[model samples]
Target: MYRYTDFDTAFVAERNRQFRQQVRRRISGALTEDEFKPLRLMNGLYLQLHAYMLRVAIPYGTLNSAQMDQLALLAETWDKGYGHFTTRQNIQYNWPKLGDVPDMLDALAEVGLHAIQTSGNTIRNVTADHFAGGAADEIADPRPVAELLRQWSTDHPEFQFLPRKFKIAVTGSANDRAVIKAHDIGIQVVERDGQIGYRVLVGGGLGRTPMIGKELADFVPQADLLPYVEAVVSVWNLLGRRDNKYKARIKITVHEHGLDEIRALVESRFAETRAAFGGHDVALFEEIAAQFAPPAFRNAPTEVYDAAYATDPVFRAWADTNLSAHRIDGYAIAQISLKAHGETPGDASADQMRVMADIARRYGHDELRISHEQNVVLPHVHKSDLPAIHKILKANGLATANIGRISDIIACPGMDYCALATARSIPIAQEIATRFDELKIENDIGELKIKISGCINACGHHHVGHIGILGLDRAGVENYQITLGGDATETAALGERTGPGFSADDIVPAIERIVEAYLEHRSGREESFLETYRRLGMAPFKLALYGEETAKKARAA
Candidate 1:
């Protein structure tokens, strides 16, 4: 958790003050909705279908108890009783009145959080591995670099109004929990001959045109990272398509121009940018890095955890599914699931947020993290505290042991809150999760990532999911399409469509057929859905989904 310095605090205060005036002008009719659009977007406010949605950036997904409490307070005071955690690791309050937005921003500023750069066509929140600091296999924590990028891009005049919105994700682990390959800029912190550097990837994104980022630089030394990143963005800023918003992203730019040409342009630009840096950015990175020093870990026996694991099947199930290895002995990372069986995927009530905040402060080193999977992470919990933490989480409806399962879905706000959505997505996600829970075979099925988006925008990251669901309006009815075998990992690949779309009524059954097909065709129970899909390919699943007659048609097409 990086504490805000006096400068940081002052900077946020000034921004909030400015936004407050902007908000008043809009409310007072000094500015119309069209005039207020960009101003509101710059401040992370969106005029949704029903009401204004305020998206607050949880930079690098890091938070302390106080910040979490402030989020809960915002949910309780201004909007509905719950807040939606997004795939970007940001939080959205979907029911705020236009006039109360400034007060909400002030409340967020008090906790060192803000809504800046969340909605605009700018570098969005710089996300990182939720388990950054204490992951078992991390080379280094990626949050420091994420924070550095946040400071670099927040209001960078040169890069703010790019051709389209840009996103950057970082990961220090070899396992790719941050989905770096699916970002506009993916940074992997790697060590080369004991010298820390970055492996930079560019042009990776998920939308109408999904792409896995290409390797822009194999090893950029720590000192050269900022300039190199800037050069890449600068090159794309000038080269990208501006006439059509659909093709404006850097991914399309890379596709239009070969990676080699992009690399050459970036390198050429890098030379000038690197010289301009003159070691200042490196110095600043070092100062920023110090703020992210790991919390002092305490050594203790895990007798309580051992006892609970042996005695309570309930606790054991949660521990097995929700817990991950921590770097330190006797410590573990606990993932709190917001996707309860029949509930919304990422909506957390204010009380539940408070409970998590309390648990983090009590037994998790006073630090909490929001994962891009729409879950919360207790990144530094001692094993000895697992039982008590699980007990607390269970009482608050946060103890769902379905992490990485079929029910642990990633879904966008869709038609329920997003005006851009063509059809509803939340109901589809809820139905799928509920149906699978009814089946009681999720544990048997193994790791599955089902992502759903209401449209082609891919906000839910459906392009990277094992079972990707896209909801669209077909003629006048809601239709859902499916893509199989897509991955968002070190070996990232986009899923392929499984033929004709299904009606909303048939979507769940189609998914069930796909799962059944996976179960029957897999080499063994251990063979996951993704592995089975890879081995058997789309032929069998399409046959299962569309049946023999339609399968022939799909294959022919």
Candidate 2:
């Protein structure tokens, strides 16, 4: 993990001091809500339905034990007992008072973490693969470049306050675990002619108008990475729409003006931007890369892990679902599931956080990562430590044996916390999870992604889910719409809506119908829901959800 430099430390301290003053002004009525809105947003504070929510960034989802302990302390002392990890690899405190936000910011700064740029139209948190350094199939760790991008974008004068919020994600692996295709700018680390570089994709997003980004550059040399990125965002900053808030995103801009024109404009701007860099950015990247050098691996035996798997079915199930192949032999990437059955997805209690921190300190090389899917990751855990870690996680209610399964849902706060939401999303997610658990066939169903969003903002990443659910306010009633065949991997695609929507009460049953239909239509158990959906389009699923008569009537009409 990269330690904060003196400059980084001082910068955060100063920002906290300024925010403290701003918070005091707001509380004292010197600044009205309107006046304080942008100021607070810049520091990652939002006025939710009932309280002020603070979003703290976990850059590229990386953290150390000390930082995790601080976060746990913040959750225990200032706000509620738990914090919600978000799809952006950020954490949210849902009940912080206006007066306490400054103190919270200061507390975060103490641990070399901050809420800066977690919100606002400025470039948001630079996310990467959760298993950046530990994944077995990575080209190279993407965190160094991600950190470089973070340094370049944070408070950049020319790019601050763009038309709307921007997001960038990088993935070093070919598997695309970072959901790169759903970000404003997606960079995949690749090698061309034995030279490592980036394959840039622009205009990808999932809000009101969902789009899989177009390839901006097939391969941008690592030397020109920062300048090329700047050029792309700069072009979008100027060309993106400001007349309509809904149409202001770079995705919309790219949609309106074809990729060719956008590419041409970016190329034109790249010439000047690249010239001004003078190789300094590349030097800076080299410096950052040094900070992210891989941790020393232990030559631990995996005999214990094998024994545990053989004897304990519970540990075996969890290992089967939550563990991934690590780069180093005898090591495993352990995904701590926050989505424990019926609980609110991605929420970790203060005690649970502390337990995870302790486990990380003892067994996980003092490193932790937050996945974009909202799970905590111990990226480098020795296989010998599996049983002990699983025991602790189980005791803490953090062991859910469901990582990419149907029950491991990704859900936004929805109307319960978000003011922008039209309907309740959390309850819907809970209901579906509980229903699936009762069915007891989640493992049988295989790897399924069930993502739920309250509205069209797609904060839950519903657009790219294998089985996406979008909750809406339909004539004062909570309606849920389902989409199928959407994927977030390297071959990403936006899910297609399956006919009419269902009411909240009927949504779970509707989903069951779809699942049952998939089972019936699939070639075999080997074919997953997504694969079946892709092979046999939405017709079968629609027929299942709406009955044959309704499907026929709709088709006939």
Candidate 3:
């Protein structure tokens, strides 16, 4: 929700001008594909299999109604009439032309949004908790800090070309909804002896080498956050591997060089950088905070809300599933589900965006949010507005009543779209969600997370799901690998891989077996699937998935 200042606006305008010229050169054949690649990548454009993909940054997944309208306009005008929201809280358009991207960028700039740093091997978008400002349990809103880092890192000459892409996530709540530990740098806002500070974690990531980062600093005063962050990045920038892309992420660096050594190096750099610290940007933070101020709440019609809840079963189901905790008493966070059974996980049509925008203005507090899980949140909707909002949402195919259920999956654009992918992920996710819903097992089994990635890039946060599915190509055939017991909450842990990969035909049945095993092995309904998995280990799951004969043969061996 941070508004662009005059300076910010000017900078974006200038960047667009340069990119327009670059696009002209490419179209005119003055620049070759090789020459145009990095230039377009800098502006968040990628050449996909069928067309060019443009990833637009939605800073920390926060957007106003106007911004949502602009995204809808871009989708209608530029490429397809829809956009794909990603795990990093950004949106991607899969069908932008090479020449029309600059115009799209200009449209985004008009709304104080741009595609800058959405991709490339440089510092990407700084993400935080989607419910940053609205969470009732938050110590402070993390968006201002995210906004600060965004401005600091945007086109920073020193970090534009780092050894590998960097990601930073911040959360102000005790619950780690942002999956901070799976980021290159994770900052948690905490209180120490009555003073506000940050708990910093570095070198955590979820690619081939998934790791839960170790705490680097217990509590760093807020005033020193930027300088200390600079120190950490400077150390990594100087020492991180540049030759091998696979070994260049901070996670790899921390694995090779011990955490103690990296901590020491960061401390040394911090000592030097802290000495030269000019002053704190208190005024800037205040300015940013003002932009995100809470919307004015109106008195609600309590009787109307009670009557709707009492009368409408469909509205009741939606309220039970799609509504989230809000900071305000009379208000709630209404989630617009993109995971509507068999559709692509994050794809939203232009008309859906428009509907959401209208709902936000009419019922919500004029604030819209994009969850990391690829859903939209009307952050401050009054209880009395639930029926009307739900009606419009239902008309637009947005009322799914599945927020954290098995159907609500996070999937990356896999082999179908991504050039780097080895197999398809979206179809697999769709199949699984649809199967579970059809079987009527989603609610019966309770809360479960199933994340799928097309490859080992882990863009879907597969490594952190309760049930992680990784798709791979084996001799030109698609195969799926399952990992269980992963979590992304405060007690974050990477899932341990199960035995052998399953064929495409066998994957869904295997998942069903695993779920059935959890139910059979659980102590009671109170114990969830993960708790049962942790208690019994993978042995039962192996038997359930592959048959007891196979399990017995492996055990005998």
Please state every model's RMSD to the true fold in angstroms: 1.0, 1.1, 1.4
Task: Please write out the lDDT profile of model 2 over residues 433-521, one tens digit for every residue.
Answer: 99999999999899999999999999999999999999999899999999988999998999998878999999999989988998899
Instruction: Estimate TM-scores for all models.
Output: 0.99, 0.99, 0.98
Worst 10 residues of 3 by lDDT: 276-285
Q: lDDT for model 3, please.
A: 0.89
lDDT of 1 by residue, 401-511 (tens): 999999999999999889999988999999999999999999999899999999989999999999999999988899989999999999999999988899989999999
Tell me the lDDT of candidate 1. Answer: 0.93
**Cα misplacement distance, residue 456 of candidate 1 (Å):** 0.8
TM-score for candidate 1: 0.99
Using TM-score as the measure, name the better of candidate 1 and candidate 3: 1
